[model samples]
Target: MARNFIRETLAKENETFLRRMEIPNKDSWSPENGPTSVRRHPFCSSLKMFLVALSFAYFSKALSGSYMKSTITQLERRFDIPSYLIGVIDGSFEIGNLLVIAFVSYFGAKLHRPKIIALGCLLMSLGTFLIALPHFIIGRYKFETSVRSSANSTNNLTLCPTSVLVGNHSSTLSSTGCENESRLSMWIYVLLGNILRGIGETPVQPLGISYIDDHALEDNAAFYIGCVQTISVIGPVFGYLLGSLCAKIYVDIGFVNMESISITPGDARWVGAWWLGYLIAGLITLISAVPFWFFPKSLPVPEGRLAKCSPERTSFIKDSPGLDHKYQADEQFSFVRLAKEFLPTLRSLLGNPVYVLYLCVTVIQFNSLIGMVTYKPKYIEQHYGQSASKANFLMGVINIPAVALGMFSGGVLMKKLKLSIMGAAKFALGTSLLGYFLSLFFFAMGCENAKVAGITVSYEGMESLSHQNSTLFVKCNAHCECSKTEWDPVCGENGLTYVSPCLAGCRMSRGSGVDTVFEQCNCVAGGNLTAYVGHCRHRESCQRVFPYFLALCVITSFIISLGGTPGYMLLIRCIRPQLKSLALGFHTLTTRTLAGIPAPIYFGAIIDTACLKWGHKKCGGKGACRIYNTTAYRIAYLGLTLGLRTASFFLCALGLVVLQRHIKRQENGTLSNGNTGHTVAELQALRKEETHNSHSDQSPRTSDYDPERETRL
Candidate 1:
């Protein structure tokens, strides 16, 4: 009976609060009184239309990000660069975001949001197209090979000196300056393109979310966002699938005689059609941009819902002179005004201890997340001995889908439970800890290192090789005319890996290119003195472990992503409603700068240290690291990730305690001031109005906690 009385009292309080906060329909909202556009199309005002455009925007950006992850190794091989260089390229996007995100997040509210978003999308499309430009302009992709054949594989005629002995077409050999090339850093285009993409993506999240929150039903906001996220998740799946398809095709398939290529997709030095996925993704991005151009600055709010905020007063703002610097709705755009007030507002926000604690957790979590994601596919390929094509396919079809489902499920749980700020924080904390715990098993799930001559195993297979033993000189190949730096791997029939025929002490080689085989290979054991072209296949033990690894990945992805939505919503609830945009923008800016930008570079650099065999560049500098010490790679990759996240959890626990205290103080302050009502800003007021709905919908349960007793505002 006491519980029932308390519930009734809070219900009455909430009902009274909602009635006072409600806006007058005639005075606050109407298309007739709003800012008139050049073309006031009805579709621009439709919430459904804007939602569609926003969803597409989300899809396009995610597709590009995930696709880049899938193609990291391919890009490394194609550019003849090391892992660290690719990490730099990955970090370039964050650099672009850091440049324009603050201004866009703050000032963009004063402008046409949809049109600005459309412009950003166009920039992304152009950037995506630009990333593929190197492939077209770089001439034919000449993968490094050391072979000599008399006839072509595709033409049965000598096409080039390196052609295989089975072809249908023949072209005379033509040598270019490629052999003596020096300025091999053609990856600059991909970097700039990624930077443009980052700049384009900057406005989408803050602006788009703010816009939706402005006009959508307060109760449905989280659910709607969840739906959009679920749709957006589809992009990565397609991206990975697209990446997989492209990786199977040879880099210069149609342009060159593919039959004469000595390496398979399984070969460490192989470069796939990594550029093609970008072109297709860009085209999709261009299409996504089209719908946004037609959307208006603001849409008319539905009945019972509060009207949208005026453009002059942004949803996110910087307060100067005082904690509350109120702006008139008719104030003009002024750089002088914003410049004067920016720092004080920033300082005031940073002063919130709870927000600071949350920031610590986010920055640390993102560091781990970014580092793992940036090198995850490479980790799979190098550790599991999977091909690039297979790794991408698995990531796309299995891992990403799990994440998508988890994200959607998280949002649904929030809406269904109507979790308060405290509730959301607890839920996020639990899921994260659980996921981290489960991920601990990945360290144990390791594949044995590939057997490479002079690297992991001896050339004659008589003894094991150590890290100190790098030179491929044995009793059999000691007198062979071979350069230590020359690395064109060949698979010997004696189940041993050889550096090359020259290093294998082979006097003569039969056929050329793809059809090439070295006979009388002195390095091979007595039974069969023959060696085929390209790297040897992985052992059966490695292949058997792949299925279990993939299953674990799917489960881990789902559990980790389950926390994503709750964590996001918790962030929204923790900040002042008016400063939502600024808080989100600041969070993204700091996280991207501190974590996203540096994570990949450092992760790749560490992984680079584990390289057992480094591919050669055209000008003879260190190219891509072809083989990695699997044990070392695993330790570097997972250790850093797990360590960062584990440390972040301490912050998460602290943040939870801090949040509880903040809520208590905030409630006390509200009670002391007797401020039972929200201000007359439509969007902000509606959030308060929904407080009654959020509480009353809850079922009475015997518990240690009671939200009704604490909600003073």
Candidate 2:
């Protein structure tokens, strides 16, 4: 009875307040008058259409990004670049974003958003196409091999020479110089293209999300964003699947004869048809831009909702300490004036303890996320002894779909429960903590190191080899004169990988291509043992572990993704509606600069340290790592990932505490203002409008917390 009396009193006072403010009453407004008065093309103005367009934009960009990650190893091999160099190329995308994201976020919000997104999509397409440019411009790929087999030669190939061949050093130098120059050129093009892609992607997330939240039914905003994110996750699935398919094909397929190729897809030296996927992805991105061109700069607020701010001007600015800037909708645009307000606006955003703490958690977590995702496929290939094609296939068909489902489920959970900011923080924190604990299991899932003579195990299999005294020379192969740098591995019957058939002291070889078999291997423990092309297959125990590792990955992916939507909501909800775009942009800027740009580079450099075998470049010098110390690799990768996540949870707890205090302060402030009547009245007005529009959609719960009201803090 007391609650009813207070509600009725607030309702009456809200009616009077509405009339005094001259805000249109529900009966006075329709599709034909006031804010919803502007006539629009039905298809172009519908929120559904905008959602579809934005989702596709998300899909296109995600596809490109994932495709880039999926091709990391291929790129490393193709350019003969080290992992650290590849890391730089990978980070170039973030570098591009850092260049333009701030301006695009703050100013682009005031301009035609859809058109700007269209422009961004076009740039992304161009960039995708540019990444593939090297394949066309560069000559046919010349893979390094110690073997010099020819179809016209005798069936049995000769053994290694008794003495090492001393070729013209100057000619070798010139050839290496030319090869390095070519490699440098290819990677530079990739770097620039990726940066362009990053720049192009800057406006898509902030602008599209802010636009949707602004026009969407407030209750449905999280669901819509979730749908977009869910669809976007599908992009990576296709991207990696495309990568899987391409990885099986020879990189120079059309230009090179299949019969002449000696390497199989599983060979460490193999370069896949990585450029083909880029062409297909670029075309898709170009098409995604079309719908954006037709979308309007703004859409009408859903029928039942009023503007997020009050008629007297939002309290976010007036209530904020040291923040005194205001821009009216009718005010003329001024670059200099807006520029002057940028710092103040930024200060206002940073001043929020909740936002700052939230940013800290996200930034720390992203470092681990980016590094892990970027190197996961590589890890699978190296650690589990799986081929690149197989690794990509598993990730595409298994892990990505789980993430998509989790994101969608997160949205559904939010809507069904009507989670407030505090609820969201709790939910996100719970999911993340659970995922982190589950991921600790990965460290135990590592496979034993590949048994390579003079590397992991001794040539005789009688002792372990240490890194300090590692040498390819042994009594059995002392006369073979093998090149230590060569990485054309052959599997001995004794279950060991030799750097090359020459290093295995094979006297002769038969057949050609992948079918080649070296005979009379003197280095084998027993006399006249045979060896086959390609590295030895992984142990049965390792094979069994790989599937279990992948299964755990799928589960962990789903659990981590379950927090994605709520966490995103927490970000937007904590900021004032007017500053949503700038806040999101700044958030992205911080993450890209601190996380995306450095994570991959440092991770790559660290991973490089575990390299047991480095592939030789055509001219010499260290190239991409072919094999890793699996124990060290696993420990390093999982340790860093979990370490960062562990650190973030500390901040997550702090952020939640800060958020609770902020909410309590706002609650007290609402009661003390004597305008609690105005706040309740606004809610009453919105509720009455929702009641009238009940047939159009499910009504939002009256008790659901309004983030806009909390904006005053």
Candidate 3:
């Protein structure tokens, strides 16, 4: 009887275990099953989606801009529009974006984020289509003109102006008139197109950032934002490539050669070729809209029930509620209130020494980068005598490695060193600035020495060396040694035929009584005037100027890149998870507001002024004129460098102070102090809890426990 009782009890225990297992745990299950699993995590998948969307939008926008960039100068020439005015027109898109971002960010928290993103995408597509209309008309006109020109040439005698006879009037009809009509149509279309593009792009910046903010965790917000920035950087490169390809196609199709019987100069051909590239760019923008349709319509958030009381009302409750309460409270927080709250938070942040210091550093770094982007090409073209396209290509190529290494190495170094996020930021900013400075130095040195000798010493000058000169010119030829007759015979006889006369003459004349003549020649070659005692004063000035300029470039690059890293890192690290997205949005907003709107236009004005003063003949005026003629660019660079440096200095100081203050506060036990060593572990635990709650659809009534206050002594 006892053995039978034991078996029945064991069976009852087994049944209880099976029943518990069979009951579904709703908390752990995702709302959407299958492929959506990959996208369920807001911390990862939503951020990735936002990045991809931004990448597409930015790429298309930049490409459209590139097309305009390549063609705008030609348009100015054809239509007699001021280049600066064209620049303003070009900047309209950025202006629109700025306005849109400000409005969206202010109101974004209240709106359905997916709907906002969709609206942005729709606008972008519509704008792209509108922008393309002008180019398309222009393209068609050119095509028609080419056909007509071919027909006219084939029947030259019958189509002659003096000839009264024509076999078929339709066949002999002038297509040039149609081409003109198309050109007129293009002018009208371009204005409407730009307006549409501006409107489309307006909501993009804020909406995209807000979406990411809505979805991503605070700790990882910076990383995701960085990814967004990385994707953004790619836009310009793609735009350039696409524009170039379009231009090439136009050239191949003979659309660029549809001119009257008058002989077209090579420069004119080049101008036409460039314009054709722009037209192609617009078409590409129009085509980019096709991809938007495939974008996911909406993203799912974590499932949870709303709290009984609003977050404002919950302030009456002294004790912190459970996870469920906090979740509901967060959900009920009004976006407007959040935006208003941001101002105070920002002000507090600004007031904090550490935060201020970081901000200063970041501003400097950003400004330096912007300055480099704006003027580096011009510097190369002017100081190095490189073509604009070549200069742009080189700048882009060099940056690929530099930026990649900077970002990756900066992150690694930060992690390895266990630097505070702010510290890591500062270090990165400093390093990048240093790198920029070095690059600038090299660039400047290259520019100065490019023509000093036959040998190319700088990137700008090195590029000037043709294949013909590379083989024919000896190393000694660079020092103008071939012109020194006195030591040429001796050097050549000694198997040092390429040696400079200054060196050989100095060595040979040293032993002889003819030192004075050789010394005079050497002085002349070195830019020293030994003719008079005081004349040597000018020599030092000449020798030092270029080196100083090069040094400035180094300093500027270093300061900018260095200062920028800290703020960028801070944005990644310190902000609360829920607030990080908004912080990042603000960061982007500031950058775009300050830099994006003015940079291109400012550079364009510089180019125009330079061209007008220097004469187009020397700087390819009939085409896009280079900004090499004036010191305005340098002045601008200097101003930016100084501003950034000042800001960095302040930010660094602020950060240090804030950090020190926080340390003091912790030591004094004025605030709840958690074990610093266990911060990471606690964060991980919190994340796990959040994950559990999200999947289970648990209520927000979980008890509130402060990890910092719960540590065992």
Best by TM-score: 2
What's the candidate order when arranged by decreasing TM-score? 2, 1, 3
Q: After superposition, how far is residue 461 of candidate 1 from its true place, in Å?
A: 2.0
TM agreement with the true structure for every prediction? 0.80, 0.82, 0.54
Instruction: Report the lDDT tens digits of candidate 2 across residue range 438-557.
Output: 998898887887788888888987777767767899888888766677788889999998888878889887776667778889887664999888888857888898889988999999
**Candidate 1: where is the Cα deviation over 4 Å?**
1-45, 149-184, 213-224, 296-329, 333-341, 415-420, 663-713
lDDT at 291, model 2:
92
- The predicted structure with the larger lDDT, 2 or 3, is 2
What local lDDT score does residue 384 receive in model 3, on the 0 to 100 scale? 42
Candidate 3 residues lying further than 4 Å off, grouped into runs, are 1-83, 106-118, 128-199, 202-233, 244-253, 256-269, 272-350, 356-365, 439-566, 572-582, 606-609, 612-713
TM-score for predicted model 1 compared with the true structure: 0.80
Tens digit per residue, CA lDDT, model 1, 1-713: 34655566655443332223322222332344332221253423477778888999898888988888889999998888889889999999989988898688778876889888998899998889888889987877776566763444322322112223221121112123445443646799999999999888888877887788776777877777867876788878888888898999888878876656888888887889988999998998999889888776666435434234333221111111211122232133245655776787788678878788888899999999889987888888888878899999998888888887898798889889998889989988888888889899988888777788788887656676668866677677665445566577888887777777667766556676678877776777752387889877858887888788888888888988888889988887787765676687788778988998998999889889998888775455788887888888899899999999999988887888889998787676555546646332333334554664465558544562354433322
Candidates 1 and 3, the one with greater TM-score: 1
Compose the digit string of candidate 3's lDDT tens values, residues 1-713: 23544445544443332222221222332334312333444524544755776666666666565455544534443333445556566656666676666676666545555555556656655655565444444433221111122322321221112222431342344343433443342444455556566666665556666556544555556676777767666666655454434433333245444343211211121223444544455455445444444444434432221123234322322122224443346445545556667787676445545444544455555555554455554454455443345444543444433554455555565667778754665575466446544544442343222122222211122344332343323432234322211111111221121113332222111111111112222222332212110001112333455446544543443343433444466765654454466566666667666655565566556455534112121111233331232244445444454555556655655665676565465444422334454343345555565665565465544454333222210
417, model 2: CA deviation in Å?
3.9
RMSD of each: 10.6, 9.6, 17.9
lDDT of 2 at 229: 69
